[model samples]
Target: MMTIMRNTKLSTRTAAKEASHERIVCVAARAIRRSGYDGTGVADIMKEAGLTHGAFYAHFASREAMLAEAAGRACAEAAAAAADGVASVPPEQALTYMFHAYLSRENLEQVERGCPLAALASETARQTPEVRRVSTRYIKEMVDLVARQSPDWGQPGSHERALVSVATMVGTLLLARIADEPALSDSLRAAALQHLPVA
Candidate 1:
């Protein structure tokens, strides 16, 4: 009976530790998305997560370790969201759905919870080797997804179209974030969507 009770207590502790780790990742992801990679710090993430700085080391080896995991989580969430948008649409309409969803005003205003690549892509180019590699893989995955939805194009054109589409979406969102006027943000989205190839 004592052994059984001790095992139960250990299981509860393990479960609680796992839950705390998940919460840390969730809070870190949100902060990184809202404040860019370089802008966010370990202390801030821990404080925001209601965990202590020392406790962070218990969960992750370093800030970069957490960043890589957070980036992966963010990518997965974005991919799921994008997939949700395209799941019900026909293959031909996939581009329309993706482009429109990506360039939407709501997405633009919610960068903290939007596409991970677009949110910290510029900073990603300068990330640690592991982070850059993961970012590269994420980009390739997105391109493949777009290609799957665009079967009408030739091989070269398919790849080109995917690249162009992603580039346009990311570029437009970045520019929109920088522009001083709300109209300019709207114009950026309009121009990108208007110029994209449609089926």
Candidate 2:
């Protein structure tokens, strides 16, 4: 019975620690999205997480380390959300869903909670080498995921197609956000979607 109690206690502790780490990642992701990578500071993330600066070292080696993990997590969450939204549709329909959803006004207004790559790409270029490397890997992973959803492409030159799709979507979102005009944002989404080939 004593052994069982000790094991249960250990398990609870481990679970709590993991939950804390996840919280830190989530906080960092939001901060990075809102303020860009360079604009967000470690102290700020820690404060937002309700954690101390010293506790940050327990979760990450440095801010660059945290950024690397946060980038991957942010990308994975966005991709997973996109995948879930189109899971039941055919590949062609899935692509359409992704394109429309990405360029939609709802997505544009929630930049901090939307695609991290689109939110942080410009700032990521100025980050540490590790952050840049991780960001590159995450972008490639996202591109590959989208490419796999292209029914007409059949893998050949799919990467290029994915690049074009991502570039167009991100550009549209960025431009719409910068313009800050509701009608222009709607027009941008419509125009961008109109150009995508229907499979």
TM-score of each: 0.93, 0.87
Candidate 2 lDDT over residue span 1-199, tens digit each: 9999999999999998798899999988777887888788888888888888888888887888888888777777787788787786776688888888888878887877898877886787888887778777777766776787787566667778888887888888777877867888789889999996546
Clashes of each: 0, 0
Query: Which candidate tops lDDT?
Result: 1
Q: Candidate 1's C-alpha lDDT?
A: 0.85
Candidate 2: worst 10 consecutive residues by lDDT? 150-159
User: How do the residues 96-144 of candidate 1 rate in per-residue lDDT, one tens digit apiece?
Assistant: 9899988998998898899878789789988888788777888888887
Q: Model 2: residues >4 Å from true position, as ranges?
A: 1-9, 155-158
The Cα error of candidate 1 at residue 109, in Å, is 0.4
Query: Cα RMSD (Å) per model?
Result: 1.5, 2.2
